[model samples]
Target: MTANTLVNSKLVCVALNDKAQLAALEGTFNEAPYKKPPTQPVLYYKPRNTWSVDGAEVEWAKDFDGNDVAEMVVGASLGVVIGKETCRVSAADALDYVGGYTVVADYSLPEQSYYRPDIKGKCLDTSAPVGPEIVAADKVATPDSLSVAIKVNGEQKSAFDLANMERSIAELISTISRIMTLQPGEIIAVGFAGDRVAVAKGDKVEASIEGVGTLTNTLGGA
Candidate 1:
């Protein structure tokens, strides 16, 4: 596993009670129009079987019906690790609860407009490539103002100003805490920017933020 994928990215240990099914969690962020602090934090989970580390590759699978699988989505998100137990936190005190930050590339096969209900499309092995390193939160002055971008096959494809995020970093932390207790070392990935594209085998994916360095991985067949 690469250091960039997990360090500071909140890793939540889950249990699947039934033998036939696995537990999963989906990563989320606020989209525009709903900008300014989110009224509430958003969350979703994938079956536990779908996680993978850096350097691993995911194979494209055909659905039950015979149709060429057209697209997939890879989400590169900024993860925030909570430093202390926080519940019902105030926005002003949110930054103090952060332990650090990391980068995670969340992958989904065969692009679908909605993220949930399409869990099978997203939870494939080796789809999530994460790690490089975790930069301490103290090192970043304004987490909400950082610049994030992505490149595929050395071509720039997606870019977003962190300032444009629907919700500020601190606000998200505070808002989410109210729903569930955020523990030390727990992770929270900032949502993706508007740009989403398709990728294929042999392509290289790179995600970067201004203060946080880049994490790169290549797509390949199983």
Candidate 2:
């Protein structure tokens, strides 16, 4: 299904390990050094425009530099699909709200700042590719300790264990629910632990999660 058909409100993509990401961000916040990391979940909503199904083609539109500039970064992350309307949920009951899990490849252009949301940089067409299949949350043996990785053209560029998340999936869901009500079919892309790599046209990107399976997509030049 298309993103609009699957989601009604927003798709929250958590930015875990706030300190590492902040160190990479391009600018200052409030004209001061942006040193303090968010104590709570750092969430960014990727609208339907950014969603694409697994195996779909994601367009890497040429930039002001023309065809030579077709490139975007891919963030391979575990995703939680909400099973019901969730609001003010508790960490203890957070997983109960999850319907299933899916692999998500969050695509975006290189940006230097988090002080402001970069709509165009992140919400481009086919930016968030999710699927392969949704594994029921209960069936995911250990969602908190799965292995995650990203590959480009069949070569692994980055690999990491979810064991390192600053906040577990349950805690993230609980914190996020307090910020906004999540509806059925909407998703929360659990944060990535390491660096995201840039991919260009003609490249095939794959996001693999140990239990959830891999989501693959090809990059096409616009």
Per-model TM-score versus the true fold:
0.75, 0.87
Alpha-carbon lDDT, every model: 0.62, 0.78
Candidate 2: where is the Cα deviation over 4 Å? Answer: 1-9, 18-35, 64-70
Runs of candidate 1 with Cα error greater than 4 angstroms are: 1-39, 46-50, 58-68
TM value for model 1: 0.75
Candidate 2 per-residue lDDT, tens place, 23-109, comes to 544344325545665556667878877777888988785565565454578888888899998999999999999999988888888
**In every candidate, how many clashes are there?**
16, 1
Task: Please give the RMSD to the true structure for each candidate, in Å.
Answer: 8.8, 3.0
